[model samples]
Target: MWHGDRNGHGEGGGRGSAQGWCALALLHGKIEAHLERELQGAHGLSVREYSLLDVLSRQNSGEGGHLRMGEVAEAVVLSQSATTRLVTRLEDRGLLSRYLCATDRRGIYTDVTRAGLELLERARPTNDAALSEALDAAEGRPELASLVAVVRAL
Candidate 1:
């Protein structure tokens, strides 16, 4: 099994190799922080916020990607309560709206508003650029480059 250094990576290190565990942890943080800064500075959205919006964007909810609260949480990998608070925050900004499910009044769903979509679209480039730069930085290392490519796809 790999063991990563404190920085969370060992170049050319295999998964769970002796040298590292969480081999990409540091790199992931670096890329995520860059994207976070870009989105926050330009659009006032955090990475989690953008990820939630992106998840909704891919949903087939006819009304601008409406999704049940649980569904949204699952899709974005956020806790139920966390997603609730996040939805509230976005709702407050008019970026998202929550409504009772028409057929199941007990079920509440959150939908992305035009504002949310617009912001997400704008954040896309920033997200891409951050990921691209990080990957490019590791391009010269064969193993790292391969890992970067895999992560970029993910």
Candidate 2:
């Protein structure tokens, strides 16, 4: 059996290590699925879309506040091509817009539109609630309780 270590690292990079990784993946997947279902049902937004919107909404016109496409990809944990497609999808829905950077003509920055911001504002609570519910449920599971505790501690 794969018992977790006190430090949450599992035992010395052995079977416990693999089990720890699997447990972490399970925790993440469950939480993401819960968030997805809630966000989609309540706000017509996928987890990725909501995350992108949330990331973009934090941008400011002040220097270095606006993120380039690459930076956005990093922030949202998507590949550059995937991020571009996501941006395009949001743009089609009038949720986001892109413009060339004033300081660097070769650079492009994306911004969440008013519609996107409004939707994000509404979906934020749903996201938070779903995350909380998922973590609470996971905390009840032996395999996931430690991971959930770690996440909560973080």
Off by over 4 Å in 1: 1-20, 62-66, 140-143
* Candidate that would win on TM-score: 2
List model 1 lDDT by residue over 1-154, tens digit each.
Answer: 7766676766556445743334466556767787788788888889899999888777775764567788888888889999999989988999888778887899887778999899899889988887687678766665466667777688
lDDT of 2 by residue, 1-154 (tens): 7765676654566677788989999999999999999999999999999999999999988878999999999999999999999999999999999999887999999999999999999999999999999999999999999888889999
Local distance difference test, per candidate? 0.78, 0.94
* TM-score of each candidate structure, all chains considered together: 0.77, 0.91
Model 2 residue 1 CA deviation in Å: 27
lDDT of model 1 at position 52: 90
